[model samples]
Structures are given as C-alpha cells and as structure tokens.
Target: MTTELQFFMSESKKKIEAKLPELIDSLLAPESLKKSMIYSLEAGGKRIRPVLLLSVLKGFNQPVEKGLEMACAIEMIHTYSLIHDDLPAMDDDDVRRGKPTNHKVFGEAQAILAGDALLTYSYQLVSTISEEPSKVVSLMTELSRAAGAEGMVGGQVSDMEGENKDLSVEELEQIHHHKTGDLMVVSLVAGAILAGASERDQANLRHFGRELGLLFQIKDDILDIEGDAETIGKPVGSDAGNNKGTYPSILGMDGAKQRLEHHLALALSSLKEVDMDQSLLIELTKYVAYRNH
Candidate 1:
C-alpha cells in the first residue's frame, strides 16, 4: 500500500477502535454484557466499514470528525451482525479474527443479547449525532434498511436457503447484493449525507459501494479455499464443507478471477465519475480487491 493510504487506514482504524469501547462502556447495561460486546468489538480485523465511510468523507474534503460518530455507529451494527453470524445456528464459526467466537466465550444467550444490544444501540448513537434532524433521520432510515429485513438479514436468509443447491451466478449475486452489499451501500451513502455532497455524488458512491461489496464477497469466497487458516483467522474451505454456493463453485476458479477483475474495473469506473480527491478511496478499493485477509 502507498504510505499515504497506510497512514489514512491506520488513523481511521485507530479512531473507530477507540470509539467502539467507549460506546460500549457508555451503555448502562450489565458489566458482563458490556464485556461481551467489547470483546467482539475489539477482536481485530480491518474495520473496513468505518474506514470506508471515513474515506468517502475525506474524498469530499469534509471534516472527518462529522463522519466519525456515524462511522462508529455503522461499525457497531456490523460487529453485532458478525457476533450473531458466528453463532451455532448461523455460520457456526468457532473462530473469528483469531479469537474464539463470541458465543464460545460468552455463551450463546449472552452473545445473542450482546448482538441485539449493539444492533439497537446503533440507532441511539445515530440519534445522538449533532447533525440536523433530517440528516439524522436519513441515516436512521438507511441503517434500518441496510441492517434489517431488506438488507443483511434478508441476504443471510437467502444464503442459508441456497445451501447445497445449484445456484446460478446471477442468483448468487442477488443473494450477496442484499446480504453483504447493502450495509456497505449505506456506508458510502451515509458518508455522502454527512459530507453534504450533491445528489450526483451520492448516486456515484451508492454504485461504487455496491460493486465494491460484491468484490469483497468474491474475494472472501476465493480466500476460503486458498487462504491460510492461521492468516485468515479461521479454518479454510468451510464454505465447501457447508455446501454453500460460491463464486468459484458456480463460475469456476478462473472464471471467478475474471469476474473479480470485472468488478474491480467497474468499481474504479464509478469513482471516475466523482469530482473529488479520490486518492484515498481508490487505494482503499484496490486494497479490498487485493487484501489477503
């Protein structure tokens, strides 16, 4: 990565990481519950959603401060989704970010409650953002749509239902567009909202985020087969073990790689329409395509 990109990522990640625990601590919930939420929040990863939101703000030359709270709120929702996603009933993942899954440490009931807490608390955080009421309402609506039945929850249901079935490429993309792409769409669009960006910019970012989200899931499918378990912080090849449909499974390895290239091109092209300093956003998009874990 370029030094500037590295620096931007580091700074953004640091800010969000600090805010997560602080937000968790601010809750008046039980100590154990707070600990459970903080545990998964602190579990290491790229913090990609918040970082992407911040990058969009930077691209608009807006004060990164305005995006920080919204960025952290979106991340809280993302973390909650991960905690639930790793439960025995979901992906049943035993490991995440090299640590034992939240349920494994907190028991399934507490983990579920922690996830619920984070999901609900996100709105409260967004409500507290000092922006105008209309902007806050817009963000709240976006969060609900992205994280609720219309977005991640819906995608997850499609994913579970499609397991062990012969799914076409378009069907797979449809599943991922809701399951993985929607929240990311909100991230970029929410950044635009905070930056007071124009309608054209918002539309461009919405498209960019969608393409990038699929690019993310496709890389994930590739990594599940080719990535090292230790490096990826989980067992490799679990998708196949679970009989889940994947880009490589449906498209073939070579075809999946070609598809990856196609989306990368489209994602970059979307950014070309944006009139701003996209140096950081462009590098961040490249990192998503090329990251090892």
Candidate 2:
C-alpha cells in the first residue's frame, strides 16, 4: 500500500472501530453470543465498505456523522458475510485479515451464530436511524437483498458449483456480479441516495460501483495466482488450488490486466458525471484498483 492509502485506511479503521462498540451494544442479546459477535466485529479489516459509504457522503457535501450509523451497519453486514464465507462449508479459509478465521477461533457453531446475529443486527441498527425513514427503509431493503439469496449467497453457490468446471466469461461475470458486485453496487447506491443525489446520479454511482467491484475481484484473482503470501496476507493461489473460475483462468494474464485497466478507466469516467466533489472519491477509485492487499 502507498503511504497515502495506508494513511486513509488506518484513519477509516479507527473511526469504524470506535463506532463498533455502540453498534454491538445495541444488538446485545445473549451474553455468550456477544463474545463471538464482538470478536469478529473487532477483528482487523480494511473497512473498505464503510470508507466507500463515507466517501460518498463527503462527495455530496453531507455531514459524515449523519451517515456514520449506516456506514457502520454496512460494515457489520460485510463482516458477517466474511465470517460465513470463511467457514468450512464455504471457502474454508484458515485466515482472514491476517488472523485466524472466526470459525477457527470461536468454533464452528458460535461462528455461524455470530454471522446470523450480525446480519440481523445490521438491519436493526439501520432501522434505528430515527431520521429519514424513507432513506433508511430503502437502504435496508437494498442491503437485505444484496446479502440474501439473490446476491452474495447466490454468487457463492455458483462459485462452489462451478469450482471444478471450466466457466465461460459470461458465467464468471454472473458469479462476480452477484457475489462481489451486488453489495458494492448497492452500497454506493444507498450512500448516494442518502446523500440526496438524484435518481439519475445514483444510477451512475451504481455503474461506477459495478465496474469497481468487478475490478476488485479480478485483482483478487490475480493475487491468488501471483501474489506473495506475506504481501497478500493470505494463502496465495487459493483460487487455482480450489479450481475456482477466475479471469486469469479464462483470459491470459495480459488479457486480464488489460480488462482491469479498461474497467478502471470506465470507473473514473463514470465519476465525472456525478455533480459532486470528486477529490476523495477519485482517490478511492485509484486506491481500489491498485491495492495490493
């Protein structure tokens, strides 16, 4: 990571960590479950989704504090997804964010429960916003759909089913569009809408998010193929080892690189149409495309 990227990432993480306790406090249920919930919530991650949400708020000249709750809520949902995704039933990864996966630390049962709690708690937190009921309802709807069967879950199913098969480009896109792109696209849409952007502007934001999400997964595929374990902070070549469909598997390395570059350009171009300040958001897009971890 570049110094600037590291700086912003660290900054965003601090903010999210500070907000986490309160969010979890609101969801306090059985005391035993709290441990797993807090454990996974506090585990270190890039806070990319929250950062993107806040960036959209800043872009539209909205008070960042106003969106902080929604930002935290989205991060909670994202973390829940990661916890479940890392379970043995899914990707079966042993590590995440450079630490033991949640299931490894908390045991499979608790980890599964933790994901369920966080997913439910996210909607609760979002619904408690008190102001802008319509916006909150709309964002909640988007989030629920994105996290459910039609979005990430669907993408994951496709991924698992096609792991050992040769997947076409269209099929790969479908997998990514649901699994990775859906949350990202909807997150941007929610953020833009909450920030008072017009429908046309929000649609453009969705396009930017869709392209960025695809590019994000492509970079992940590249890392799986060629990234260093220490540098990428996880097991390298997991996709290939698992026989997962990836851009590199279908397209040559050079071709994948070209496609990533093309999407990056398109993302930047899409931002030009939004009638808002673009400094931080522009920087964020660049950071996403070039991120090494």
Candidate 3:
C-alpha cells in the first residue's frame, strides 16, 4: 500500500476507535454486557468497513467527521458479525484479530448478547441521525436490508448449507454478493446519500463495491492457504480443514489470483464513474485488494 493511504487508514482507525467506546458506554446496559461489547471493539482490525463509509465522504470533499456517527454504526455492525461468526456453532474460531475470540473470553451466552446489543445499538445510532427524516429513513432502510436476512444473514445461511458440498463459482459469488458485498455497497451509497450525490453516482459506487467485495473474499480465500497464521490472526488452511468452498479450492491458486486481478481492474473502472476526487477511493480499493490480513 502507498504511504499516503497507510497514513489515511491509520488516522481513520484512530477516529473510529475513539468513538466506539463512547457509543457503548453511553448505553444503560449491564456491566458484563458492556465489557463484552467493548472487548471485541478494542480487538484490532483495519476498520475497513467504517473507513470505507467515511472515505466515500472524503471522496466527495466533505468533512469526514460529518459521517463519524454513521461510520461507528457501520463498525458496530461489522464487529457484531464477527462476534457471532466466531461462535462454536459458526466458524468456531478460537482467535480473532490475534486475540481470544469473544466467546472464548466472555463465554458463549455473553458473547451472543454482546453481538445482539451491538447490532441493536447500531440501528439506534443511525435512526437518531439528525438529518432530514427522509435521509434518516433511507439510511435505516438500507442498513436493515443489508444486514438482515435478505443480505448478510441469508448469505450466511447459504454458506453454512454449502459446506463440504461442491458449489459452482456462480453459487459462491451469489453467497458473497449478499454476504459481504451488499454491506459494502450500502456503505458507499450511504456516503453518496449524505454527500447529496446524484442517483447515478451512487449506482456507480454500488458496482465498484460489488467487485471490491469479491476481490476481498477471493484474496481471503487465497490467504487461507498461504497467509501467515500470526499475520492473519488465525490458523492457515482452516477453510480446507472445514471443507468450506473457497475460491482457491474451486478455481486453484493461480486461477484465484487471476480472478482477484480481474476484479481489481473492474473495481477501478467502475469507480471512475463517481464524480469526485477519487484518488483516496482508488487507493482504498487497492488497500482492500492487497491487504495482508
């Protein structure tokens, strides 16, 4: 990644990290529940989802802080997903972001509650946005659709059912489009909405986000085979051990790499349609496409 992008991401993370604790602390939840929620939030990540949301605002030459509340909301949703995804019934991961999983540290029940709390609070935060009622409604509507059964939840169900079964590339793509891509697309669209961009501009961002999300998943699949356990914060080859259908498993390593490159090009192409200073967004795409973790 470029030094400038690295600096931008680091600053972005600092902003989100500072705001997350404030959000959780302002709630009137039980102490244990608050601890569990904050514990997972403090676990290290690149803050990509939230950063992506803010980056879209930056791309429009708007103040990044204008979207900080919404960015934190996005991060909460992403973090909640991780907490649940690491449960014994799901991916069963022992570690995340190089620390013990929330379930491992807080026990299964509290971890589940923490995830539920975060998910619920995220919507509350967005719903309270001081924008016009229409924009607030638009944000809430898009967020629900992206995070609910029609999006990530449905894709996760499909993922669980597809385990150990041979799935076509189209099937895998379908799973990820809703699973990972939709949330990302909505992040960009949310920014466009906040920035008062044209509908066409938002559509362009949606197309870019789809390809970018695919690129991210394909790279993740490839990394599951070749990434360092310490760097990626998990055991290598876990997907293969679990018999999950991954891009490398289906397409072979070289083919998966080729596909990653293909989407990178397409993402850049689609991003060109956004009417803004897109250098930051372009760098952001490369950041996702080429991340080590």
Best by the lDDT measure: 1
lDDT of 1 by residue, 1-293 (tens): 88999999999999998888998898888999999999998996888888888888988888888898899888888899999999998888888777899999999999999999988888999999999999999999988999888899999999889988999999999999998899899999999899888889889988999999999999999999899987776789977887888999999989999999999999999988987788998998888888887
Query: lDDT for every model?
Result: 0.90, 0.83, 0.89
Better of 1 and 2 by TM-score: 1
Candidate 3 Cα outliers beyond 4 Å, as residue runs? none
- What lDDT is reached at residue 88 by model 1? 92
Q: Using alpha carbons, what is the TM-score of model 2?
A: 0.94
Q: Find the 10 residues in a row with the least total lDDT in model 2.
A: 1-10
lDDT of 3 at 180: 92
lDDT of 2: 0.83
Question: What residue runs in model 2 are displaced by over 4 Å at the alpha carbon?
Answer: 1-8
What is residue 233's positional error in candidate 2, in angstroms?
0.4
**TM-score for each of the candidates:** 0.97, 0.94, 0.97
lDDT of 3 by residue, 171-284 (tens): 999999988998898888888888888989999999999998899899899888889987887788988888778999899999999999999999999999889889888998
Checking candidate 3 for backbone clashes, the offending pairs are none
lDDT over C-alpha atoms for residue 236 of model 1: 90
